[model samples]
Target: MKKQQGLSVIAILLVLALVGAGLMLVFKIVPVYTEYGDVKNALTALSAETNVGEQTLRQEFDGKANVSGVTSVKGENLMVVAGAGSNYLRAKYQREVPLFGNVSLLFHFDTQAGQPPAQ
Candidate 1:
């Protein structure tokens, strides 16, 4: 008789469990990253505009954030930097996402408009 050519029942169940865990992580983590994108877009847009006051920048970011459904970084968290020839908007924040019981993921986000993204 030929040897078993496919996964055993136990092996299949283990694979399924691993796949389920991966899917759960993706579902939980993707939304947070999406919100980060929204935050970055808001910063980029604000940085492109000509604004003199930090308060104006923050207010503009808040409006964009509200429309974008971004909750990770708020307008109050933004920093206004005056560069040589232009002004930039930056946001630095961290998020703690709870996984299963006591296990959580920590994410650090720092974004500066008019500059390359942080790696």
Candidate 2:
């Protein structure tokens, strides 16, 4: 009897299916992270600037979000933390992405200015 070579048909199909699923997940999650980056940048920019009132911060964040095309977290979602010298902007939100029939993925994002992004 001849020895089996490389990957069999079943193995190849299984590998392909796994790869496809991984690709789909990446494709679905990448955009959310991209938007999160935008949100972080906006908050950092706002924080670096002069300290302002909470309402002003919200308005500023809204403008920045609009310009940066960040739709995941809006200005209203931001929480302004007033400090003595500078202000901190915190954004906490959740995103639900439907993968396949009745299956969904949930992502929780918590980002703050002058700090690192949270998962």
Judging by TM-score against the true structure, name the best candidate: 1
For model 1, the superposed segments whose C-alpha errors exceed 4 Å read: 82-85, 115-119
Best by lDDT: 2
**Deviation of model 1 at 94, angstroms:** 0.4
lDDT of model number 1: 0.82
Query: What is the C-alpha local distance difference test score of each model?
Result: 0.82, 0.84
Given candidate 1, what's the lDDT at residue 31? 92
Candidate 2 lDDT tens digits, 1-119: 99877998999999999999999999999988988998988888888766577788889899988987887788888888655467788999998889999999999999888543333
Question: Per the 3 Å backbone cut-off, how many clashing residue pairs does candidate 2 have?
Answer: 0
**How many clashes would you count in candidate 1?**
0
RMSD to the hidden true structure, all candidates = 3.9, 4.2
Candidate 2, overall lDDT? 0.84
CA RMSD (A), model 2: 4.2
